[model samples]
Each structure stands twice: as C-alpha cells, then as structure tokens.
Target: MKQLRLSGSGGQGVITAAIIFAEAAMNEGKQVVQSQSYGPEARGGASKAEIVISDEKIYHPKIVSPDIVLSLTQKAADKYYKGLDQNNGLLVVDEDLVPNIPDFPNVVKVPVTRIAAEKVGKMLFTNIVALGVLVKLSQLISLESAKKAVEKRVPPHTIEQNMKALQLGYDAV
Candidate 1:
C-alpha cells in the first residue's frame, strides 16, 4: 500500500488535488481511500488531505506513516515531514512557499507556486501544477488519468489553463 499526504493552506486546492489523485489511482484499478481536514477559515488556514492506495482492500482510511508527503507550506512541512516512512519515502515541497525543509534524503524541492504564477500566469494553478509534479515524481498514476480527473473536476472555462499548468509542472521536473 502507498500512503500519500498533501498539506497546505486552504484554497490551495489540496483537497481537490487529493480527489484527483484518488480518481487517477482508481482509474488504474487500485483501491484508494481519500480523506481531508481543514480549519474553519475557508482560505489561508491549514488543510490536509490524505490518500491510501493499494491493490488489496483498504480497511483503515487513515494514514500513519505516509510513503509520500507533499508540503506546500512551512507549517505543513514542519508538521508532516516527520510522518514520512523513515527508510523509504518521498518528500515534495514548494520551495517558494516552504523556506525551511527538513533534512531528508529523498526530498524534491520544486517552486510549484512560482511555476504556476510565471508559467501559467496564475497562482491559483499551483495545486494543478503540484498534481503534475506528483504524477511525474511518484509514477503511481498515469498522466492521462490525472489529466482526465483534472478535466472532470475543474471548471470548464479554466480547463485549458489548468492543462497548460499541468504540462508546465510536468516539464519542470
């Protein structure tokens, strides 16, 4: 089983990213469980979304030691980075948003928000770009499946820009 935790501020689309990731895993015939938590504030509050994927049945929905953790903020990195698998795990962080990354062997530092703002011309596309990075780094889900999920979840008018953001993110690393 693979456990993934995506953490960031609210309105960064962490929950939506988790849903899309779960959908992509499901598309690959994997059993996926996704859950989320956030503060009362709608935006700029701490938010976390967890996903568990396996070929076998998933009995527990919660994740203890995640195989992959994406931290888009310094607070999230400080809170969740220790929960990663000690021996083998991947830590992905937004370099621009997270200034202090823990000392981890398998850490991937990407300027996701910066890339979204500069390449896609909107910071709102950060999550989609992060999704693309996750897809590329983890290889747990196919790009096609992720794209399909994005198409299904995002607003129709923003599909083109989101796709561009996704592609730019994929190309970044």
Candidate 2:
C-alpha cells in the first residue's frame, strides 16, 4: 500500500485533497482509505489528512509513516518531517508558506498557493491545484480519473473553474 499524509492550514482543504486522491484511486480499481483531523480554528489551525491506497486488501486504516508527505504550512512541515523515513519518504512543501523549513534531502518545494492564485486567480482552489501536482508525481492513478473525481465532487457551477485550476496546476510542473 502507498501511504500519503497531507497537511496544511485549516481552510486550505487538506482533507478535501486526500478525499480527491482516494476517490481517484478508487476509480482506478484500487482499495483506498482516507482519514482526517483538524484543530478548532476554522482558518489558521492545523489540519491533516491521511490516505492509503493498495492493490491488495488493506488491514490497517491509518498512516504509520507516510511514503509521501505534503506540507503547506510551516507547523505541518515541522511536525511530520522528522517522522518521515529517509530511505522511502518524499516530502513536498509550499515554498511561500514554509520559508525556513529544515533541510530534508528528499523534499520538493512547490509554491502551490502562489501558483494557484496566479494561475487560477483563487486562493480557495489552491488545495486542488496542489493535489494535481501530487497526483501527477505519484502516478497512483490516471490524471483522467483525478480530473473526473474533481468534477464529480465540486458544485456544478464551479466545476469548470475547478477543472481549469487542476489543469493549470498540472501544467505548472
């Protein structure tokens, strides 16, 4: 199974991103489990989501040590980076939000929020954009399935815009 732990500020849609990932994996006929936790604050507090995808049956429902960890906030980066395995773990962070993050050898810095605001003109869709980049990197599921999953989840009126956000994100990398 492939484990992914994604975390960010409360309003950044970290949980939603994991749900999207799990949905795309499910569309590809894989077994997927998603779980999330968040602080009390609605905007700035920490939020985290864990996703596990496997071809075989999944017995454990939680992420022990994620293979992929995406951290959009500095606190999230600090909290999870130390726990990641050096041999198999990969970390992705938002360069703008986490300026002074520690030097992790396997880390990838992506200006996800800035990219989303500049390319899609919406901070609200930043998480979806980040999810696009992550899904692209993992190749856990096809991009088509991911796009379809986004379209299915978003509201009808906003679906096109969100898909455009995903495309912009996919093309950014």
Candidate 3:
C-alpha cells in the first residue's frame, strides 16, 4: 500500500487535493481510503488529509506514518515532516514559505507557491501544482488520469485553467 498525507492551512485545498488523488487511484482500479481533519472555520486553521492506496483492499484509513508528506505551510511542515518515513519516501515542501528545512536525504524543496503565484496570478494554484509534482515524482498515477479527475472535481468554467496549472506544475519540476 502507498500511504500519503497532505497538510496546509484551511483554504489551501489540501483535503480536496487528497480526494482528487484518491479518485484518480480508484479510477485505475486501486483500493483507496481517504480521511480529513479540519476545524469549523474555513480560514486560518489547520487542515490535513490522508490517503491510502493499495492494489488489495485497505484495512485502515488512518495514516500511521506516511510514505510521502506534502506540506504547504511552515506549520504543516513542522507538524508532519518529522513523521514522514525517510528510508524510501519523500517530503515535498513549499520553499517560498519555508526557507531552511534541515537536510533530510529524501526531502525536496520546491518554490511551488511562488511559481503558482507568478504563473497563475495567485497562490491558489499551489495545491494543484504540488499535486502534479507528487504525481510525477512518485509515478503513482498518470497525468492524464489526474487531469480527468480534476475535471470531474472542479467547476466546468475553472477546469481549463486548473488543467493548465497542473501541467505547468508537472513541467516546472
């Protein structure tokens, strides 16, 4: 089974990104389980999501220690990066938000938020770009499947733009 966790502030789209990833995995005939934790407020609060994907049926939905951890904020990074399995896994972080992460052999620092803000005119695309990067690095799912899942999850009018954002992210790193 491949376990992953995504964490960021309340409005960074971490939970939604996890759902989209799980949906894409399910489309590929994998067994997937997803869970989320967040406060009642929609802004300035901690939010996290966990996803487990396996060829066989999954027994538990909770992520004990994620094989991969994606962090968009310093708070999220501080909370989850230490818990990531470094033996053969990765920690993807937003470099713009975090300047110095102690050298972890498996960690990758990407200026995702800055890249999105520069290319897309807002940092909202950070989550999608980060998702694309993870998909590329892990080869967990095809970009085509992820794009289709995003289309299904996003509003019709925003689909085209988000797809471009995903592609930009995939190509950026």
Identify the leading candidate in terms of TM-score.
Answer: 1
Higher-ranked by lDDT: 1 or 3: 1
Itemize residue pairs with steric clashes in candidate 2: none
For model 1, the superposed segments whose C-alpha errors exceed 4 Å read none
lDDT of candidate 3 over 56-142, digit per residue (tens): 988877998789998888888888888876688688888888666745778888888887789876788778888888788778899
Candidate 3: regions farther than 4 A off: none
- How high a TM-score does candidate 1 get? 0.97
Model 3: lDDT to the true structure: 0.86
lDDT of 1: 0.92
Q: What are the lDDT scores of the predictions, listed in order? A: 0.92, 0.87, 0.86
State every prediction's TM-score relative to the real structure. 0.97, 0.95, 0.95
The residue-by-residue lDDT of candidate 1 on 57-148, one tens digit each, is 99988997898999999999989989877779899999988898898888999999999999899999999999999989888998999999
- Score residue 65 of candidate 2 by CA lDDT: 78
Order of candidates by lDDT, top first? 1, 2, 3
